[model samples]
Target: DQQVKQNSPSLSVQEGRISILNCDYTNSMFDYFLWYKKYPAEGPTFLISISSIKDKNEDGRFTVFLNKSAKHLSLHIVPSQPGDSAVYFCAASEGRGSNYKLTFGKGTLLTVNP
Candidate 1:
């Protein structure tokens, strides 16, 4: 059973628009949620993260929202630029020190039309 799931396979948006990516999890043990962006051939690079204790976290143009009660989370990119077009994977893991492994979604391919 996949713990983390991204229902949408892809998303398209204008270069200056907002991109919203959704993610869901079935495991309640997950205490941390993260979003990673991957290029065509490059490794996934971490974008934003939120702890179970908080409902939201923001970094510059990226914002991550977590709804622990529903086991749901979302990543929002405002004014998405052309370079922001990439595959985004939502990952989850337990708290630090438990040596937990991350569970990742299939990924959503984001296309920012120039």
Candidate 2:
């Protein structure tokens, strides 16, 4: 069974608009959430991550929000640009330690129209 899920398979946004990607998890044990961005023919790179202890985390133009009670999380990109277009994967881990297994969602393709 997939523990993490990205309901929207794709999202299209105009350049300079805000792009929001949503994710949900069935596992309550998850304590950490991570978002990865992948470009065509390239490896997925870590974009931003949030710990369950906090409701939100921000880095540059990207921000991630966690709602533990709802078992949901979302990533927001401000002033979306063509360069920001990519497949975004939502990942989660049971704990912060090394032994925890990571679970990943299928990913949501984000297209920023310029």
CA lDDT, every model vs. true structure: 0.95, 0.96
lDDT of 2 at 102: 82
TM-scores, in order shown?
0.97, 0.97
Backbone clashes (count) for model 2: 0
Model 1: per-residue Cα lDDT over 1-114, one tens digit each: 989999999999999999999999999999999999999989999999999999999999999999988899999999899999999999999767768789899999999999
lDDT of 1: 0.95
Q: Which stretches of candidate 1 lie over 4 Å from their true place?
A: none
What's the lDDT for residue 81 in model 2? 97
> Which runs in model 2 stand beyond 4 Å of their true positions?
none
lDDT of 2 at 31: 92
User: Which run of 10 residues does model 2 get worst, by summed lDDT?
Assistant: 93-102
